[model samples]
Target: MIPLSGDIGNAKGIIRENLGTVETRRGTTTLKRGFAHMLKNGVVMDVTTVEQAQIAEDAGAVAVMVLDKLPADVRKAGGVARTASIRIIEEIMDSTTIPVMAKCRIGHVYEAQVLDATGVDMIDESEVLTPADEFHHIWKWDFTTPFVNGARNLGEALRRIEEGAAMIRTKGEPGTGNVAEAVIHIKNVNTELRRIKSVYDAGDEQDLISLARELKVSYGLVEETASLGRLPVVNFAAGGISTPADAAYLMTLGCDGIFVGSGIFKSDDAKERAQAVVLATTFWEDPLKVKEAQKMVDERQSMLGLDTKNLELRMQERGSTA
Candidate 1:
């Protein structure tokens, strides 16, 4: 993998050198990205309780995201959505053998610190919760825990990677059960990447610099991404994926995997829906398998989806400027 930042030391070395203490959990860019690599071609599910976490594990999730509310519920109970309770997070952690992920509000560094101390396998600096800092995101290089952030376009995705995000996911309009926004974001990133690759092939060094400037990221990182023809880190599809078809569509679109939030548990058959999503994600290229997975759930049992246009809060818009 291309190191967006310089080679970082081990997690313990990072903590001792940067934070003035020795912490067992060391956060290194390589280590973090390595963790994300293990999750490729898999699904990461959102869960609020130990039971849900266990259910996700049983359903073959590579990881579980511990959150206080499902994205749809967070939208309905329109208030501050912060990191989940530590007690619940700890319980989920204890109950599952699979990696446990939890969210922190965007730019909330201290909240990240708290989650890091709690020892989550990964931390999502999520827009699903209200962003705590609008102008800047957390400098993820400071933490031991790996972070995943949302992006709506190529520039946002590259900027987050430059800032030390171990993983990137399209910031689709969450809780809406709509996949259109996710499709747009992923296509935008792919299109921009192809454009940059062509420019690189032409050996237009100055134009590369201009492209980096437009993307709001380091020129070296831009060049590296162009050379590789993709983001250096794993990229996952997220937001509004409520069905097996949605999961398979994204996989065919070249996403490393999918993140299903309110889609699974909010359905009438959480267990069946969860398992079907995993099956679809794993066998995404096989139309017959995907069709079978789709048949496993009834559309009527799916969560009441909100049209993306009608959403009062556009979480996907967060960090879009960056």
Candidate 2:
């Protein structure tokens, strides 16, 4: 097992190298975005307790997101899911040396405020929780901490970025161990990205403006995304990812990182699965390495996956629009 102290120190060095001293200043867009950049090629695992957070860290997760219940449990319980308790969040924060993150219900400004005030390294304005407001999401610019939001397509992503989200993740049907919905979402984003890139390359300003209007986002944001040939912020694949192969496949699909929700702790082999995912994400470009990582865990131990089409609650659609 990797020594906890050594791994954390190494993580700090990587953060420093990715985010220079000046860029570390709080609240600025660059700083907020820079924070997400530091987590590229990494895994962010959802954890409900200090022990799970420790396992996440020891398994080499770049960060741990505290939640009241795993996505699977939330799905099964069928109630108003909310942000994790402050007491639990604080306890996990105290226990783990790595950066800690927590989720707030979509559009719940107070929940976000509470999380920001708790001094979490980042806040996920997540659709996995019940939406507090039907039509809108929290304005992330108001907070000093970086925010990550879920997106189903380029339009939703750009709108979230316009609202000051520092990072974006595909809102795969959370709680479902099945990765199909996540795959579809990423492909949708990629297809749009390519179309816009082609439009920008052709210098069709009118068509680009039309696309912006069609997407219900600002033209400038569309143009910016087109120019970059990607989302303006780091994009991670979240929800439904359950195995080493799942993590590696998303990396191949252009995600900057991976977010495993119920995929870890709900599995029959949480520790082995967590380590395998981290390894697969880091070496996704290498088939041999991914194969080795896959061999570390048993497929039967994975969480029983749900079919996205049959889900009672479509978590991805909650607060998807601006």
Candidate 3:
């Protein structure tokens, strides 16, 4: 079991002191990216209230993302979606020992600024919220706080990176309980990475340059990615990840971590589901362990999945330029 609330608060205070040093070192890509690197292979769960945040931390989540509402509720109640309330975010941060993250609408600079000023550990320039700008995203390099952005392919990932995203997640169809779109996205990014790797291996600089033009990203960034044979920074899987199996499957696909939105709090068995997903994510390579985690939750208790082919709002398409 985790520590009591009083102990947790004391530990979080120590963590904040260390984080203050990290924040001072902001604008340094190494420090910004390193902050994300520390959370690799962990689960980051979406939460709306202090109670949900505590549940997530106790379930062994590496972090909790504060939101005004769960993704499902946001999609069901279609209006202008924006950032979560500052009071709620601060309250969660105070309550949880784990890192606290919050989302801002895609291309919303001021929202990101407000979140940063509020001292969140990370900011997600998310497509889940309504787009505040159609043709642009926040220039993340200017901020001291790290930002994570969503992408569907290599080009989009590279573009977000160029614009200063410290981390990248697949822009899977959020709010739905189906993992099909997330699967499709990771596969797409892998295919594109393989294509670039092969081109670089063939020593075709000219071809790489042409591909960079096609991707609309800097040639140097493309070359670096090709040499590395993967994204330069950590990449996670997000959206529609509901079950333990879903979490494990994405881990097998080379994601650095997992993000659970409506998958936890929206389910009938939130606490059990949260713990099970974390277990599966951590032991994804061990089939027996994954099976044990899968047994912790019942399928009937899961959220009703939405079909991606029949969605009215495709959140992933909102602020994508490539």
| Candidate number with greatest TM-score | 1
Name model 2 segments beyond 4 Å from true. Answer: 1-25
Work out the TM-score per prediction.
0.94, 0.92, 0.92
What's model 1's lDDT at 158?
82
Model 1 pairs whose backbones collide? 11-26, 11-27, 27-144
Relative to the unseen true structure, what is the C-alpha lDDT of residue 8 in candidate 3, on a scale of 0 to 100? 13
How does candidate 1 score on lDDT? Answer: 0.90
Task: Give the range of the ten consecutive residues with the poorest summed lDDT in model 1.
Answer: 4-13
RMSD of 2: 7.2
TM-score of 1: 0.94
**What tens-digit string does per-residue lDDT give for candidate 3 at 1-322?**
2111101111111222246456333345666678888899999999999999989999999999999989999999999889999999999988888999999998889999899889999999999999988989998877878889999999999999888888999989999998999999999999999999999999999999999998988898899889889888889999999999999999999999999999998899999999999999999999999999999999999999899999999999988873
Order of the predicted models by lDDT, top scorer first: 1, 3, 2
- List the global CA lDDT of all models: 0.90, 0.88, 0.89
Quote model 2's TM-score. 0.92
Off by over 4 Å in 1: 1-25
Model 2 clash pairs are: none
Candidate number that wins on lDDT, 1 or 2: 1
> 1-322 in candidate 1: lDDT tens per residue?
5444423343332543434565454456667889999999999999999988988999999999999999999998998999999999999888899999999999998999999999999999999988899888988877878889999988898888867789999989998888999999999999999999999999999999999998888888888889889988999999999999999999988999999999999989999999999999999989999999999999999988888887789988876775
Could you tell me the lDDT of residue 97 within candidate 3?
81
Q: How accurate is candidate 2 locally (lDDT)?
A: 0.88
Clashes of 2: 0
